[model samples]
Target: MAINRLLVLFLLIINCNLYFSQEVVIKDDKVLLDGKQILKAEKISLAQYSFFSVKDDEEVLLYKYMDNETPSYVNDDFFILNFLTEKIKVESTDLGKVSNFMNSKKAMEKIIKWLLKERVINRNGELNPDRIVIFKEKYDENITARTLR
Candidate 1:
């Protein structure tokens, strides 16, 4: 009877862990922010983002988003970075905060172009670091008060 109870408890733990899983993907060159792709940098150097863990002291990376932020913990994709290293490393610390600002649909449509400095595209899109300032200015122009914690 005790062994049966232990098995059930173990299964419950596995289910809970699966429930809170999350991910950050890096594809092509652009970081896929939210369901849509955003933020085109000249070349991503240190492409990494840090978030808080559900467990205390023990840092949970790779598969943890945050409290009340996982609209689809198991299947939602957001926030992409750039890098290709087989080794996986996780660390615990007060990384910082991730916030999303509301914007108009029109602004959203031109986001990629604005991020790429409104440059003419040919075979592949080019990035201009100088235009990033303009992008920030434009982004701040259409920000809303609402933000996720």
Candidate 2:
């Protein structure tokens, strides 16, 4: 039983290390690699997926795999749903804003606006308006919620 527990712990550490090694983080609406800016997120468009494509389930699965391998902007609950209905609307309330950045780019934009309203970032110009990737959320509690290094 002890050996099994140790094995599981080892596997967990190995999995975490894999993600820790290669990270793609969002900083000031720009994509960063190894703590350096790479792609300008806001300047980029959603119509043309410059990084990962989520056209089909297979592609989404690939994204999930890639997300597992790298530091993720997306959490386990991340999803993208497209539909039109009166009941389905962006939550305009400011009280609870967690998991707001999911489903669609439009939703992400709305979340960004909300974050801006909440003063999460000085301006949209200074933060990723769509996605923000960090290594681990719990590990970065004091983090300004903008630039994650």
Candidate 3:
């Protein structure tokens, strides 16, 4: 009986971790990595993505990725945008044809704008103050504002 109880507890822990490990998507504005919204500005800034625990008074560099060339095929659509600590990488099933789309500035801008808008990255470059509260509701205390700070 004790062994069975231990196994059940272990399973519960694993399930809980898996449930909370996935990215938390914001309902209204949608652009969130983990639980914070991405920042949209003329120049992409890393500070906006950094956790609040980071020292704001410290100087940091932000890097932006721009498509320098056009994609080669119409089917080359980006399907996922993943963010790391300091960099964001976009992935597409038709990666070989991505260059074709990248070549058309208008096409590239449209795609980028859609991603920004969908992800809730304010084009005007402001952080959504309610993000933490909203995230907590969806995730049920899995993440907290104090924890972020």
TM-score on alpha carbons, each prediction: 0.25, 0.25, 0.25
TM-score of 3: 0.25
Clashing pairs in 1: none
lDDT of 3 by residue, 17-89 (tens): 8885534333332334455543322222321222111223221212122222334553422332333332333
**Which residue ranges in model 2 land beyond 4 Å of their true spot?**
1-16, 43-149
Worst 10 residues of 3 by lDDT: 46-55
Error of 2 at 51 (Å): 7.4
Native-referenced Cα lDDT, model 2: 0.33
Ranking by lDDT: 3, 2, 1
Candidate 1, residue 51: Cα displacement in angstroms equals 15
Cand. 1 TM to true fold: 0.25
Candidate 1 per-residue lDDT over residues 34-112, each given as its tens digit:
3434333222122233221112322212222222345545233233211112123222111122222322222222333
Please, what are the lDDT tens digits per residue for candidate 2 over residues 1-149? 99999999999999998875534455565445456543344323332122221122121101111122245553422222111111111211121332333333433444334434443323322433232222122122321222243
List the global CA lDDT of all models.
Answer: 0.31, 0.33, 0.35
**How far out, in Å, is residue 69 in model 3?**
15
